[model samples]
Target: MRTSLACGALMGMWLGTALAEDDVESVRARSNPAQGYCERVRGTSRAEAALEWAPEVFASVGAVNAGVAIGGNDDTPLGSPKMRVTAGLGYDFVGIYRGRTLRSRAEAECRRYQALAALQGALARGSRLGETEALQARARALAEALPQAETLVSSLREELRDGSATLEELNAVQVRLDQLRSLARDTEQARARLGLEPAVAEGQDLGALLTAFESADDQVEALAGGLRRARAWRVSLRGGYDEVFDEILDVDQDTPLFGQLTVGYNIGHLWQGKANAQAREGRRQETRDAVDSAPRQVRQLLGELRLTEQGEQQRLREVSTLVSDLEGQLREVEQLETRQVRRFRDYLLLELARLKAEQAYLGAHLKTLQSLLGGVKS
Candidate 1:
């Protein structure tokens, strides 16, 4: 069985380099692309699942014969009796069977690895979309939002001029308008992080740059997720072969003229088709559970993104108010209003708001990665 298994390992198979870094045999071809690996795994699974055969071979070079004699003539003597003799040689065959149940199963394991690679790749890509790439997308949205904000701010300002808008209306609009400004700045920071110049330097708006930076971060998280999945699938692949063994061997009969006989089966199975099937099921269940989690993860990411946007708007309001509230005014009878004091206070407040927006973007990016990775794991 050991020898047979060793021989079987040499069977032709394709491999992919995707798993090379991990130093594992995950599929037929090491260089296989994601879809290709998945297809191979499926094929292997089907072939193994349908396995059911045991070819029997036998051969012999022995012969058998018998002879009889005729009755004697009446004249010669009634006492004379007929004579007969028989002698022969022959060989029988014990079954020599070859089973595909386990071999097909081994192949199936390879296929499973292929599947894992594909899932891993997808997860990685999706995660990438969430961060650096995703951030880039958000940047675009920020750019669009900036114009809308500017228009709203201008319109509100005009309304305030007319007596149509009350103090409350003006205050509300002012708050929203300020929020827009802060978000615009955040967007700029995002872009700079990406190594891309902001779209517009002069009043370029805040969040545009940040959006680009966020996009890159999206990529980082996505790649990380995919790698995680790929690693996990590798373990499952090995599990498939943990208990495979063979139960057949060739031997020579001890007796003499039995004519060079040569076959029989010992019947042993360490890692066989049954084990393979179980492993497959295990992986399948694992993936199914992952799939179940995907939608929820994605929804959560979306929610986070929305919240981050809202947060940015909120921060903008705080910033605008901060600036507008103390519009370079010295208090009457101000004895000691050091520049350092005012600068320090304003810096702290701005820094806090800036950090929040950055953190929101980071959170959204992380969620995107989780959702993407979750998909692959499934």
Candidate 2:
């Protein structure tokens, strides 16, 4: 018998573990949709594709040109046509820099999209989890209050029959009971609709989150700087070779190789570049200012939440005190039938008030949890 019991217990534990694992998997599937689908719909894929093609685009910066010519001399119209082939190779020094700048910009854009997607998913999951927890808290509070409400209503009914309590009093107590039941049912249904369990709250470092955002923005600024530099004066060098073959003369000739050097400047850009550069510089400074102030902004937000939480806590304490006083008064007046019924009704109302206070406190806590979740790495 002992052996059988031990084996059965082990089997139960194993089954429980497997079920728990399955639940976790189900939750993950519900929370995180396919990344590919999100990327396609959100335009992340477009940026990624651009980044992927950057190398091919960069290769075009170094250009190659080729041509062929075929002609016959007037003196030998019927002879085999003379043929010439020419090719030139050139590299634009400024174009290379511009290509690199463009590739960097593409990379930055891709990262921005990826970050946005992750943040969106995290916020969505956090909202669902926070809401589920809030509803669960409210339901628990109502459950605790329901039995007291029912007892108070029953006592008031008995008093009404004895002519010690008025019908209006009984009706009022009955209504409170009904309201509690209705609220409980509604909270449960809302919780069920979420289909999510409360997640264990995890602490996230604010500094680290800020750093991630700053790094992404810095990449964009660096790319912008590179582009500005790439727009400066440019120089290109090209060389070409030509060869001719004539069947009528039964001879081959090689033309002298030619080389060319060019300097380029955009006259229109010369007047506009300075203003644009200044504008970019101003924007970069703004970004820097924002980064510098981010920590303070985050701290201020957290401070406000803390203040709200403290206020909720104080309210909960006051409600608890009222509940205690009502309970004491009820015990003292138990011998007085009508008075006992009234005190019990008062106790029930106080209980409901306490529950409401508790719910408010939980709501404040949920908001804090959501804020922290927002900063968490997805």
Candidate 3:
């Protein structure tokens, strides 16, 4: 009786799931760019995964075939016969079989690495979007602060002419106000970089760049491991059993079992192994060269992040000083005369500047995190 119904049902379910995925693959691809790219990458890996087990399956069948043997001799007396059975297994430790086994293992490892890269790529897109939102918020707040900063600078100049503020103080305040306007303009440019419109590509963001680096690195490692396996010595082991009987000889044969171990070297494989090692080493060196260049690229990006952080800090300090000066002057004016409306406007201007500084700081902070994490994609 066959007892494979449960196994067959499970296999059917797995096949059904695979067919369902194919039907939905197109729809999912169209839903989002990241998902589409990830699906394509995984599809390629699935093909690799499918073939990776073929060598193992073939080897298993070969092992079973080696276990049974039978033979009978009829050249004896008419009523007598001789029978014999021998069983043994043979393993080719060197050559095609070993190479195929190694290749299969390498392919399996590469498939797993590729899958991880695809998943990370999808997550990276979300991280890029988060960076865009933070920068956009900073740009909007800075745009509102620009006019207020201009007004404050003009008021400082007027105070300088009235002998209430020194010439040096007026110049310093003017510089700070000009710097604020420049930062606002810079923020707008950063916003444009984050936009989806047709603009000059600034290459990939830090996340995507890092993702590419990691993927390449994984490839190099997989190839290096395969090269090592190709160069190493291999050993194979096997065992089997057989039984035979001959009634004509009035004798019954007993069952026998045997095992074998083989260790071999292939002269032709030596050159092939050397060639594979050289190829893998060449690729690994190439990837290492690229990795070496990454530090310079990352340093430049980190410098930009640092500059933005410093800008936010300076702007916050300048705004705080301006607010204190405005409050002190307004307090004296309120006691000597009534200029409540002007005082209120100056207070609002200072408050607005503070808020812009805070938003810009937050944006800069997000940018710093993005640079530091610097994963591929996001």
Best by lDDT: 2
lDDT digits (tens) for residues 240-355 of candidate 1: 11111112222222432222333333333333446545554564444335555433344343345455545545665665565444433323213456634443333333333433
Q: Is candidate 1 or candidate 2 better by TM-score?
A: 2
Query: Residue-wise lDDT of candidate 2 within 1-378, one digit each (tens)?
Result: 433453354355446544765686578666544344444533653454344333221111221222233465544334344565556676556665665566566666556544444433334344333344466566556655655555566766677889987876666666666666666656655654444442323234343454555566567666776576556666777777655545545454455466778898766566665766676677656644665454345444445545554665666677666667766665765656666565564645745554573555366455645455354333
1-378: candidate 3 lDDT, tens digit per residue: 011442344345446544654555545455543444545555665565445323221122111122222446554334323444555554544435434544444554455444334433423343333354465556556556655566566776677788766676656556665565566556555554444322111223544544555465556455555645544655666667554345534444354665667675656665666766677677555644554444334534445555554665576677556667766665655555433444444545555465556556565555555544454321
Question: Using TM-score as the measure, which candidate wins?
Answer: 2
Worst 10 residues of 3 by lDDT: 57-66
Off by over 4 Å in 3: 1-223, 226-232, 241-253, 256-258, 267-281, 288-337, 340-355, 358-378
RMSD in Å for all candidates: 23.3, 11.3, 17.5
Alpha-carbon lDDT, every model = 0.38, 0.55, 0.50
Q: Kindly indicate the candidate among 1 and 3 with the higher TM-score.
A: 3
If scored against the real structure, what TM-score would every candidate get?
Answer: 0.27, 0.47, 0.41
> On lDDT, who's better, 1 or 2?
2
Tell me how far the alpha carbon of residue 313 in candidate 1 is from the true structure, in angstroms, after superposition.
20
Q: Which TM-score value belongs to model 3? A: 0.41
Instruction: Give, for candidate 2, the lowest lDDT window spanning 10 residues.
Output: 56-65
